[model samples]
Target: MPVRRFYKLYLSPSRKYVKTLKNLLGFVPGNLSLYRLAFRHKSVAQSVKKGVKNSNERLEFLGDAVLGSVVAEVLFKLYPYKDEGFLTELRSKIVNRANLNQLARKLGFEKLIEYDNRMISATRQGSLLGDAFEALVGAVYLDKGYDFTKNFLINHIIKSHIDIHTLEQTETNFKSKLIEWCQRHGKDIIFEHIPNQEGESTKLFTIVVNVDGEVMGLGKEFSKKHAEKLAAEKACEALGI
Candidate 1:
């Protein structure tokens, strides 16, 4: 065994932490600090630079992109005859916040996360696990490169835990889900339609979702109902619904 890998697994001060990560991820992290930062929620994070906390938010953004790309490729190959709409909805269902939270929980990420319980509400905690999962993916990508990260996600996480066929069969009405979430929290929700711009397609509809007067998400589709659903999906993702 290499000296560094040997130390991380057996002799390092963070040996236990390393071992736990290995068991969870199936590999020892090349950069331990990235993994640690990936699970650090803003609620318990201290600022490391000019007004920037060393939280997982940035990593989450990176991971979201990487995850989407990998998933899209897989879905594209998996369903060669599927339409764009079908593939898009399935991708959303797979990467939705609720699904990610459930997956993260099943993978034992809750035990690794760092957060201030008093600062975060129960509803918001649902987003925490999902965020950390994405952040961890970002960390893995940075540490191990794209090929390794893609392989790990597919072979280890997706194949082992996720039921793609089951998700494909499921129906998710994001508009209703978003409305229900708002109602539960006593927040106002609105779907605003934008006027068509010059040279824009007349058949296309544009919709934007606002929650409590803040712009949450926007979507453009050929059908009004489909546009609304797309907007609601974006809103849900924005609010981690």
Candidate 2:
């Protein structure tokens, strides 16, 4: 087939891809071309043209930055009294890959990705779905504006889906809580790591958590701090401290 004919054929499918994405997003993705580009796997692009750039990497970049900004804005308004560190940690928790993956799955984004074969499996595992979700947010921002994106996030992602209280209680930071408990009780806590003479892929470490020279807990893990925290958590459970 002639090169020009092949190029024309390729363009034809692109239009259909755009139509699909518009329906998927429940809005016509502006610069629908960008959304199409977002699903194009790098391998597929390479096969088609050596210099051809596809893949959602660029959109992911723009989306990542845009997501960060939007999250920051939301957090600021939600927790006006929160210190920067608290807000930062909360934002990190809210926008982490796992959280985004959950949202993507809920939105059925995995089916929208364009891949050859290998990328499809990995994409189905939620990485690409999450990336495309972020890219969709970026596209929405560019298409509509910040307010629309903000409302979309709050209405669709935050309010409708996320359970704030459950998230807070389940994944509570044990280390921070332990430290705070000790401080409140006027107790000095020390974490001591038993020496590991040999290193291994999963090396065992002994942890002894002492409160005012009394051994409160002991535990073991593949790492020192992890063992210590586990030991401390056990102590917290036992001592109710």
Highest TM-score among the candidates is held by which one? 1
The regions of model 2 sitting more than 4 angstroms off are 1-23, 47-52, 119-124, 172-241
lDDT of 2 by residue, 114-200 (tens): 767765554245556677777777777777788877887777678877775566556645567777878977889888876755664
For model 1, what is the alpha-carbon lDDT of residue 14?
Answer: 94
Per-residue CA lDDT of candidate 1, range 108-189, in tens?
A: 9999999999998888888799999999999999999999999999999999999999999988888999999999999999
C-alpha RMSD in Å of predicted model 2 compared with the true structure: 12.8
Compare the candidates by lDDT and give the number of the best one.
Answer: 1
Q: Which 10-residue span in candidate 2 carries the lowest summed lDDT?
A: 4-13
Please give each candidate's TM-score.
0.80, 0.60
After superposing candidate 1, which stretches have Cα over 4 Å from the reference?
Answer: 179-239
